[model samples]
Target: MTGPTTIGAAPYDALLLFSFGGPDEHDDVMPFLRNVTAGKGIPDSRLAQVAEHYEHVGGRSPINGQNLALMAALRAELSRRGVELPIIWGNRNWAPYTRDALIELRDRGATRVLALVTSAYSSYSGCRQYREDLALTAGSLEEELGHDLGLRFDKVRSYFNHPGFVAGNTDAVVEAYEQLRARGADLANAPLVFVTHSIPDTMEDASGAARPSYRTQHLDIAAVVAEQAGQRLGVDLTWSLAFCSRSGPPSQPWLEPDVNDGLRELAAGGTTAVVLAPIGFVSDHMEVVYDLDTEAMETARELGLTAVRAGTVGTRPVFVEGLIDLVLERAAVERGESPARAVVGRLGPVADACLPGCCRQRAGVDSGVPALCGQD
Candidate 1:
């Protein structure tokens, strides 16, 4: 083959798209919430308040649609390259469980598979938990079938530093700036705020120095987008990282400043215009729809400030191409061939095989679960 994947998943027979599942309808709401907060002992009454957010939006999460779009885009890209690859999908929390997807792959006669998770950054909830879930699911499926399916799974490296992700975020910010300027919003003093889902601060500290922490990952990408957008706009862009979707016990601390809080401060600081870029997500999921589009937008209106919400890199051509590049690079690596690892901004490239201690639940403490898909 002239290029990687031209023959289609050379070392890997299939590909799995892993993601955080969400409810599909009104009836699925409470069950989905229970699935998401199983061990946390959150009462239905408390969860109902959160459920209202879903109920407000017709009781469905856009994540499933987002994943489907990505899969379609991936198929189109692979087809354009004249490669045929089977893309199966699974989730940890909801329907189309990981076990079912693995069984489908096994039945497809796939002996080796490469997985790509929805999260671009590495964290316990994002990375290690996914590895743990996949291993557990495949093992259970093997037991159910009473034999080794001869199936093995590998995953592509994290794409936080990939040029495709950087460029997508940069373009989003530039476009948001352009939209606001068209609406007569003052650009001379507006701030661009980059937003992401907030994890517990402890989790942030636990993401470790060897690999970029979750917070560090957002900051790195935000800085690059800020600089690039500034070049496009011919002015220095003032930007800062903010968080959305904080849902935890009030007793425990999470990341700050919250997007609403930050917006208030920005209003007080005489910033009459702003742009919010959700760099932490691959798609415009629930948090992005609710936190920014609903709550934050209202706050902005009340404060009499002009605001624009930027788009996520969902199914963007470059992002899809970048994912294809990573898939091919990992395939080449599996075949024992050296391939160029693409990266941008501050970090070089994350390892294809995770370190034993990568993305612990708590700083210096493992989750006490055996995670698979790591060299360790």
Candidate 2:
């Protein structure tokens, strides 16, 4: 191990790939769901239904594989850039939990660390919930090793509008659109549908800086990608923002115009085809596979409309390179070096840390302000 260098202000010794983990086998499904919905009062019956989504795919989720690929790519990029930082991974809802990652970091002599969450948007589940988990871990270190092993963690800024993210989405939309066109689907006039996970309206309303930050971020990313895609395709494309994989009681309102419903609306409006770009997710998780690939495809078949789902930014070269750029920019800021940050959408890069009241939970937890990376 090398001593801390003064090149960056926040001298992080290691980087952690923080994510929402998924089960890898048939037996791990219920336990994983239980971990995910622990305090949400979701019953096993409902989870059993959700489990079918995983069961359909042989009781495996592609998330873990994608995350592993990202970690490996990040390590390679860091090494190529001469940044000798090591990368580890932790999950919120599966094995190799954040606590375990913390223990590993402590045991390996990592004092200060940086985290890059899998999600790139600002929402309760995407942002605040992770902070709450980190705060919980800070107080329970003794349980991990029979004594407190102090460690520091900071998170990278949400990169929803990062140029690389936009470029990745834009490239995917273009590719999907061309494929649809080759399949005799209308490309020039087909509406582009940008999809993301559905959260309660209340959560969206509380996402960031006193506005509906979550929805706003999604919309911003959608517009940027749409513009870029249109430019690349040589035709101005119209678009709509939609939600998917909504859970909880029907009485509770989540984000509106489910992707299936959106497809029907387009079909009714005389649109012959659509490019369903899942800009909301960074990887092709179960939500994308089941909700979009299986469910939405069935819906499209019923409506007699052509629908193709664009890929996520999973280990895409441009996206990985962009992440490296983000890391270096943040490191520069920490090192008291002035560097330009890149963003493609209106909201800009999300702050390195959320504001004090950012993304507060629906029934606000009294965890206070977490001593997270940007908070300090």
Candidate 3:
């Protein structure tokens, strides 16, 4: 593994907590939809149809509020631990945008900042797109605001293998298992299925990691969770990776063994119950609520399989503490100090930040760079 760079003498002036924003009310739904699907030839009528999903959920996604709460929790935790860096929030598609956050930071005399993205894996949308967003935001600030903002933004690495993340997710799965057991389901006979968002196959193949492994990371975490839970409960567990929220055209191949199809297979095999452990996502977003809970639940009902989806790793104490650990480790490394390795025991080494050229975006024709944040 490449050793982390020495921690810089200069401390980070601000910590930018970046995330994908959501609408809070009914009227905000259409505009949010447009923001998410600005390009890709999706018609306004189709967008309106899609808006119904948000409308059904009261035209608000709990993600924004949840993130706000998380920010508060993280700040309090950091302050309690004596890490006095100021934490601010920015959304990629809504109210407090990257640009707005940068302006605030600059106005507050922040010269260097650390960005902690909510995404965990390596993909065009997960990694490269965020960098593009930062670059674009910086350029726009220079052009529109007429301010030469000399800001340096560094992103934290993926924490899939961190002890806190693993522990938090493990707890979530075990909680789900207990709930199933309480429902009179036979946990001993049920299958443990891990679910995540399905990205295009081409993107997966192009991902640049130390071992060119994306699925392995998720699978590793699930296996560890299953083993630990199994030992504690004295139940045999089998785990499989299932995909969800595939949105591209039918012809464009995405991840395989979709969650709905997996449910049918499990039912066909006479599996009595199944637990969906979402190790791929950090929060319960539209995909988790509408796609998995709503659509996948319907499929599970049709197939006669009792499916239970676990909670996400959002703002849990362990999760927030893990973020603090990551920040401290990165900061120490930036200071030229060797940060001690903290293992999850089950999951492997956690990455501190993505390396250059990792998760490259697919090339665009005339624009040169892959489109970021849905081209206008």
Candidate 4:
């Protein structure tokens, strides 16, 4: 720590790296699935089937280690930016839970802690659910600790459109393009297929009353990234957005053009090579490693289409710098100062606090849950 860790971190004593947790081992798989689906009424039979995804990946998800690396990167970034703040981590499940991280922050004598969630979009699972968990943990700890800890929580605004994030994804796609070209793939007319996790139709409608919905945000980022990467490669690149990891039942419709389906369509339509960019994910989590790398790549292989999966913004310097910038921006807002928020495409910077009815079950249906880090 070359400089004091508290330089530009006023109005915020610490930064919390909030994320979704994963299984630590084979035995922890079913239990972790239970933790993830605690209230979903998912049976062990179904969960065990889903647990195969975890088991396939060496019985542990890459999320936990990626998160730790991100925390370390954020710490270094804060110090480099002349802002030092302790970076504490917490998860929605598994070890070192959110409540535990809160305790650590409280023990550090922190009053106001800013959370930088791993998810960068605005949706139920990605955004509001985390806020809901934070509220639940804070409320529970409030009762247990009795005394006034003066601790409060605020989260940085969604950075799906942040310049650094878009640039990172853009660079990743370009790298993937190079990878395919190196593999004897004809890239003179390859389409850039952007892939992301699909959300339910209801959730898509529920996401964007105030800000960009889940689908819309991805589309926005995908368009910008495609153009940027195309210009970099000097190729007249055409691109389309596709989805993966849709866990919904067949009766219910989630986002369409599944990456596999899209790849087959492309191959049938005479598009032989593609660069698959997982723009929606911020790290090489299960969704990226398994869904895109393993499953989608297999589909491309079967179709005889040359393809390569792009990296996520995991610990990338630009993305890390953008997160630190978001922290400082939020701190400025807390101090009643308006700071410039940098974004790439159409959507501007979102509000620091979530508004009422934002990311609800429906346009007008709020969960009636007492969520923190928002005006509502």
The 10 consecutive residues of candidate 4 with the worst lDDT sum are 1-10
Question: By summed lDDT, which 10 consecutive residues of candidate 2 come out lowest?
Answer: 1-10
**Backbone clash pairs in model 1 (N, Cα, C under 3 Å; residues 3+ apart or in different chains), count:** 0
Candidate 3 lDDT trough over 10 residues, lowest sum: 1-10
| Comparing 2 and 4 on TM-score, the stronger one | 4
**Backbone clashes (count) for model 4:** 1
Model 3: lDDT to the true structure: 0.78
**lDDT, candidate 2, 302-345, per-residue tens:** 99888888999998989998998887787777777878888886
Candidate lDDT scores, in order, read 0.88, 0.83, 0.78, 0.86
- Among the numbered candidates, top lDDT falls to 1
Per model, state how many residue pairs clash.
Answer: 0, 3, 11, 1
* lDDT value, residue 91 of candidate 4: 94
Candidate 3 residues 170-289, lDDT tens each? 888889899899988999888888888888876676564433456766777777878887887788788889998787689989988898899898999899788988888888888889
Clashes of 2: 3
State how far residue 316 of model 2 sits from its true place (Å). Answer: 0.6
Our model 4 lands, by Cα RMSD against the true structure, at: 1.4
